[model samples]
Target: MSVFADLHRGDEPLLLPNAWDHASATALAAQGFRAIGTTSLGVAAAAGLADGASATRDETLRLALALGSQPYLLSVDAEDGYSEDPDEVAEFARELACVGAVGINLEDRLGSVALHAAKIAAVKSAAPDLFVNARTDTCWLGDGDGDGDGEETTARADAYQRAGADGVFVPGLTDPADIAALVERLHAPLNILYTPTGPTVPHLADLGVRRVSLGSLLYRRALGAALEAAAEIRAGRAPHGATPSYDEVDALSRRGDLTHSDGP
Candidate 1:
């Protein structure tokens, strides 16, 4: 079994924190996280691109390459595989595998279901070692999980699994019953985005969810904090909360260089 497969069989669900850059990833790894994920929203926002719109392909690859050599597993959020062509997506997955990324999240986003399935199959065909986390936006896009019409979450998940996806991700799914049903039915790992209103990690683990992704929630919160702090400074007020020192921040963001030795 792969690392992801082993994680699913563990007693607790893998609480994955999505990182926006090398600094965030390294900081999380330093804090004892075994695996780190790249957030599409953070990458897009930082590059003045839009998330879920298939932009920032190169930016995502670059970020993956930067995090690849780090001493932790990397899972990238490749929005729709950056193309509708399954072969292109598969080739991209192969490249990511070459860079040492162990997993990737590919979203449907209410697009062609068949196309998504094809992408899943292609990635599996190209890089059997890479964990393909197929994402369905049924809850986030149109109708909720309870609604009858539109892309049904269960259907998409089932199809993805049959198409060779290693896992299925459903964001905006908060109901424990719905989560449990998906987890029970899907042979592959079931990953849910951690929502503030949804069940906690322990509760999700009990419900049989294999993974819990922080998604863009952390990134958005970080941005919110920065904006608030800047506003306070502009207003001649001291910034609230404890901020890391410049050196600490630098260290958190550093990527180990092989050309130089730190010895005397």
Candidate 2:
């Protein structure tokens, strides 16, 4: 199995942190995260594009090309494969794999089950080695306790798995009972989106979650910190939090040089 795929089989759930750019990804790697994922929201917000609207395909590819040769593994958040057509989605997945991405996240957005399954199959056919984490937004795009939605979620997850997904992701699934039940039904590893109000990482692991993703949480926190720092400065007070030195920040930009033997 690939190194990225092996991460899902480990004893502890893979705590995958999402990064918005090269600096964020490198910084996370410096902190010892072996794998990093790109958040669609962060990418869209940075480029002033709409998230989940399939508008950042080129930008996503550019970022993947930049970080593909880095030391750590990369899993891109390719929202709905950036297109409805399965072949186009497969082509995009192939491009991501070519750029060194070891995995890709494709969300269904509670859309057609057959269509999403076709996309998953196509992606696997196109990039056989790329780990496809098939995501179903049944719980994500809705609200409530999700009392009677478990069957629907399981059905969709099952379909994706049959379509050749390496793993299954349910973004808004948090309830312990619900998660454990889903995990029991899934043939593939289960990935849960980490939330502050939800079960802790250890708890999720105990519940049989193979992976935990902090989707957009880090990016949102970084933005919050920047806003707070600016507010404090305007108020004539020093900003709070652990701020990296200017040189440290500069060093991240230069870190890319180490990737190539000859300097750019």
Which candidate achieves the best lDDT against the true structure? 2
Predictions in order: lDDT: 0.87, 0.92
Worst ten in a row by lDDT for model 1:
142-151
Local error of candidate 1 at 180, Å? 1.5
How much does candidate 2 score in TM-score? Answer: 0.95
* Tens digits of lDDT, candidate 1, 1-264: 787667766888888999999888988888888999999999999999988888899999999999987889999999999999999999999999999999999999888889999999999999999999999888887555532232387888888889999888888888877777777777888888898877998999999998999999989998899999999999999999868787777777666662433432
Best by TM-score: 2
lDDT of 2 by residue, 87-163 (tens): 99999999999989999999998999999999999999999999999998878887755423888999999999999
Q: Which stretches of candidate 2 lie above 4 Å from their native place?
A: 146-148, 255-264
What's the TM-score of every candidate structure? 0.93, 0.95
Runs in model 1 deviating more than 4 A are 144-151, 257-264
